[model samples]
Target: MRTCYTGEVNTQHLGQTVTLFGWVHRRRDHGGVIFIDLRDRAGLAQIVVNPENAEVFATAERIRNEFCLRVTGVVQARPEGTANSDLASGAVEIVCQELEILNASVTPPFQLDDDNLSETTRLTHRVLDLRRPQMQNNLMLRYRVAMEVRKYLDSMGFIDIETPMLTKSTPEGARDYLVPSRVNPGEFFALPQSPQLFKQMLMVAGFDRYYQITKCFRDEDLRADRQPEFTQIDCEMSFMDEFQIRDIFENMVRHVFSTVQKVELPQPFPVMSWTEAMQRFGSDKPDMRVKLEFTDVADLMREVSFKVFSGPANDPSCRVVALRVPAGGEMPRSEIDAYTKFVGIYGAKGLAYIKVNDVTNIPEGLQSPIVKNIDNDALRAVMERTGAQNGDLIFFGADKTQVVNDAIGALRIKIGHSEHGRKHGLVEAGWKPLWVVDFPMFEYDEETKRYYAAHHPFTSPKDGHEDFLETDPAKVQAKAYDMVLNGWEMGGGSVRIHRADVQSKVFSALNINAEEAREKFGFLLDALQYGAPPHGGIAFGLDRMITMMAGADSIRDVIAFPKTQRAQCLLTHAPSGVDEKQLKELHIRLRPQEAKPA
Candidate 1:
């Protein structure tokens, strides 16, 4: 319908007559001359309408923001001092000789130029919202990233294969979004949380390398980084171990950053074990940008007369940890008290601290009521262990290990941003990638009083840990590895248990009885029996990767039709009521409501 996009009319195209189609981004009037910024997905081009072309000028004068227009114009350089340095087509303007107002629009609910529009209002008029330059750039960046990923994988002999969206429900990580089966009557098919099973099955089917940019659905609570449905760059490979898979994906990620974002990532990403990451940073996915780390003070506090520290230290399930904040000694008492209350959300009992006012004189420098009970030597020992310096503040947590880790880990990131005069910036230039390996095969579910697979049941236990599968599930580490960028878990995969015997052993450890396993995953076990090769693969959350690459605050910013916090799509008004006839066909009935007297 058009010869060129509005954004393509640049200084290079000056004096060339071209046809362009787009919505009127903005219209301006200076005396008798009318100017309009015409916008399409490519970007914007300034269109000038002079009285010399009376008919075209009249059409341009009537056009409002969002008016769909088609124009034939000669691209010309903007007059001196009129060039827009901020735009790609800054040096040029389209002098319209002809104009066609294809469609007129009312003033939009919210201005496209307004940055402070509420998300709800913006979503309500999403068509207009998407016309914004930033939103356009984000979507364009997303497309480039996806394309780069596909190209990299395809070059490495990975087949672009697809998996079923409607499959049998199995407990993967999240709750499945089920579709009621009309043919089967009362049965349901679930949208995949991931292509975890089918991708593994492709390995069994002898497709050594497979990849899919697939949509996954989960009926779970929404977060800034999550949605009811999301896309994943799902890939799996056979005859490869954890290290081999990690290396391939890491390069692919680097390729994506370089090609799409024009940023060259580090050559080799630093690797850290699950145990080390957790112990030092209190989180498996540690934001290396923050310099803060948690130091164990359990041993030092165990012998202390103070019960607050001593009690948790004595308990095997509990821990005592501390965070040393640089130049944080001057933090107000109210601020410290507020932080204590903040940790309460993570079930932390309270936050304790020792503010070091000065390092030259150890006794006088330390400020804490607890320091009075402990001698100077003990206080000095605590300071030395935490690597505390003058003008540093040490915050402590004593509780169950989970509480301590959750509270302190989150606080580190929060404080890294909130604390002024702190060295708060990206951990390193470009990308800092890592493969976190050696995750536990199973974590003991205290509530269920049973072991649950840490990653998934199909993941193979590390070599020599096979014997511990039944003996001590907790001691068995999976050959799983996660690719982490900064702090986000970009993707994860593990070497699968190709042997049915080993897979069965894993199932047993996860408290999945033979009958239940057969019911849920019999196809997988049956497939494994027929020559399944040693394979592993990773699936990157496409939204998250794109969001991070674009430096967006949340994954929602990158998604076109994102859901609200409650997982409702405001644009589509989804999760709405169904017609009675439609419900009847599905053999469903709405529950009756109580009658109210009028």
Candidate 2:
């Protein structure tokens, strides 16, 4: 129906007659002559319909924004001084020979160019929302990123493979979305949280290298970067160590950034151990773009009269650290109180600080309520340890280890991106990619009083650490590594437990008994009894990667149709109740709602 896209008409096609199909992006009646910007997926081109062509002009007069059209025109250079240098088709205009309104649209709910449109309204009118130029560009960028990943992985001899969506559910850290089976009454299939198990099975079945751009699900609470359903670049390999796996995937990411974004990431991205990451920055995924770090002040505070500092300092399970903010002595009292409130959200009892008004004068020059409680010598040690100079502010986090880390770590990032950090030029420019490795094999949940897999159950313990699996799981480290870009963990993987015995030992440490293991992962256990090669793999969050690439705030912006934080599809109104007959077939019964107490 069309010879070329609207945006494809340029100076090179001048004088050539072309048939373009698109929506009327904008229509302006300049006195008698009508002008329309015809837009397609490629972009937009201006179409001129003069009254001399009476029939086409009449059709153009009835055209409105978003009206689908077919324009047959002769391409010509746009008039001098009227050219739009911003557009690819800027230098040319299409002189309409024929204009056909394929479909008319009602006045759109909101203009596509309106930046302040609410998410709810945009989601409700998603078709129109996607018509916006930025949306088009984001989706196109997503496509190109996926293609680039596929091309790079294929070149490295990785086979593109498929994994089942509805499969047996094993705990992979989150609740699964279950599907009821009509054929088998009371039985359900869980959506794959990841292709974790299936990919490992592929390795045991002797597929040397495998990859999939596959969907993953997690029936957990949602956030800006999270979705009930998301995509991951799932990969697995046989006989490769952590180093080999990291090297291949790192290069792949670097290749993606270079080819897609035209920006070269560092040749060898920096590495930080998981322990170091948490201790220094209070997060597994540390944002290296921030210049702040934690400074230990426990020893100095041990003998101090202030019980708030002395109490946590004396306990091995607790930490007392200071974050030295350069030139932050001028921060107003209100701002410090606001930050104290922010830290309170993470379970911090309070935020303490000592403003270094003069490094030369100790107790006299320091400014803080707690300074008088702490001795001058101890204060000097605290300042010296943190390298606190004059006009700097030393913020302290004193609590149980986790709370201290969480509160101060978050404060670091917040301050780095805050008005003060920007005003003082603390946040660095450009990308900061790094590898966080040597993660603890398990984290002991105090409430549950049992160890949980730090990564996943299949992850292998570091060399000779298998003995500690049952004895001291806390001491064991995993052969796992995560690829982090800035502060986001782009991908994570580890060496798999190939032997059946080792796999059983890991399950035992997680407190899964033999009978339960047999029930939940019987197939995997049986497969492991046969010959299984040494293997490891990684799954990169495709949405998160594209989100960073496109500079979008949320993963939903990159997705065509995404659920809200409540996980509802506004466009389709999904998750509506099913008919009784359909529920009967699945042998499901709806429970009556209980009355709420007043």
Candidate 3:
């Protein structure tokens, strides 16, 4: 219906008659001269409908925001000082010779440029919301990223293969979203949490290489970075060790960034072990941009009179970490108390700190309640260990190892991104991608009194760590690597246990006996016995990747249709009721809610 996009018209096309089709982004009439900004996916172009052309002027007068139009005009240079330097077609304007309103629109619920609209309103009217330029650009960037991934993987001999959506319900990390089968009464097929098993099967089947842009479902608590259903760039390869797999995928990500974002990520991203990352930054996927780290003060505090520091310092399963916040001595008492309250969220009993007022004066200049309890030598040692300067604030987390790491680690990030940190130049700019490897094979659940796979059961133990699988599960490390960008885990992968015996040992370590293992992962175990090749792969969270690239605060912003935090789709109104007959056919019955006592 149109010869060119509205945004494509330029000064080079001056005097050229062109046809355009788009929705009216804005309409303005000044001194009887009508102007309409026509917007298409390409962008916007200004149309000038002079009153001298009465017929076209009359049509322009009727146009309003979002009115779909078909226009034929002569592109000409804009009148002096009337050009829009901000736009691609700003140098020229279209002199409307003919105008046709293909469709008219009622006033929209909210303006496209209104940034403060409620999320519910935006989601409910998603079609209109997506018409906004920022949303359009985000989706376009997503399309380009997907294309780049395909191009890179295709060149690397990876086959674009697909796995099943509905498979067996194998309970693991997160609860699965199940689908009831009407034909097989009482039987349910769960949506895949990932193509973890199927991809491994492909290696066993000798596919050699595989890749798929696929959707995965996990019925878990929602967060900014999470969704019930999300897309991943899934991949797998045969005969490659963990290092080889990391090299290939790392290059692919660099390729993606260079091609799509025009940004060159650092060559050979830094690699840190899981233990080092937790101890140093308190997070496996540490944001290297944050210029803060934990310093050990356990040895110095072991003999201190204050039990708050002495107890955890002497305990084997506990730690005493001192985090020095530069220029933090100036922080108010209220802010310090607020930080103490913040750490409590992570099971921290309390937050301890010493404001380094002056290094010259030991007990008198130092400001902290615990200062008097510790001897001058111990206090001086704590200061020396942390390199606490005259203007630094040394925050302490002395508790169970996990609690200390979680509390201090979270505090590090929060402080680094806070206004005070920015004022002190704590957060650095640009991309910081790294590989967080050497994750423990299993994590013991104190409540469940059982061990769960840190990555997954299929992941192979690190070299020479397999022997510890059944004996000391905590000592075993998986050959796992995660691609962390800034602070988000963009992707993760690990070498698989190709040998049947090795797989059985891992299952046994997790307390999954032969019978239970057979019931849950029989297919995977059965496939492993049939000569499965040594293989590994990574799955990039596509939503998370784009969220970082586009600088969107949440993955939901990049997604076309996203659910609320409660996981409800405002637009579709899903999770609705069904007829009793349909439920009977599926052999399902609704359960009434249990009433609470008055």
1-598, model 3: which lDDT tens digit per residue? 6788888889889999999999999999989999899999889999999999988888888889999999999999998998989899999998999899999999999899898988889999999999999999999999999999999999999999989999999876999999999999999999999999999999999999999999999999999999999999999999988889999999999999999989999989999999999889878999999999999889998888999989999999999999999999989999999999999999999998889999778988899998898889988887888888898999999999989989999999999989889999999989999999999989989899999998888889998998898789989999999999898999999998888889889988989899999999899888888878899999999999999999998899999999889988989886567777888899987776532222
Over the stretch 538-572, how does candidate 2's per-residue lDDT look in tens digits? Answer: 99999999999999999999999999999999999
For residue 362, what is the lDDT in candidate 2? Answer: 80
> For every candidate structure, what is the RMSD over all alpha carbons to the true structure, in angstroms?
2.3, 2.1, 2.3
Task: Return the candidate ranking by lDDT, descending.
Answer: 2, 3, 1
Task: Give the alpha-carbon lDDT of every model.
Answer: 0.85, 0.92, 0.91
Error of 3 at 152 (Å): 0.2
Candidate 3 wrong stretches, greater than 4 Å: 594-598
The digit string of per-residue lDDT tens for model 1 on 1-598 reads 6877778667778899989999988899999999999999988899899998888877777889899988998889999999998888889998899899899998788789899988889777777788898889999999988888888988999999888989999998889998988777788999999999999889999999999999999999888788999999998999887888888988998888888778887778888999999899888888776777889988887778889988999999998988988878768888888888899989988888889987657678888877776666667778889888888899998998999999998888778767442553413344667778899888887888998888888888899999898788889988988888878888888888898778878888888899999999998888888888888888889998888988888887899988888888888888777677776687766676632222
In model 2, pairs of residues that clash are none
Distance from true position, residue 463, model 3, in Å?
1.2
Candidate 2 ranges with C-alpha deviation above 4 Å: 594-598
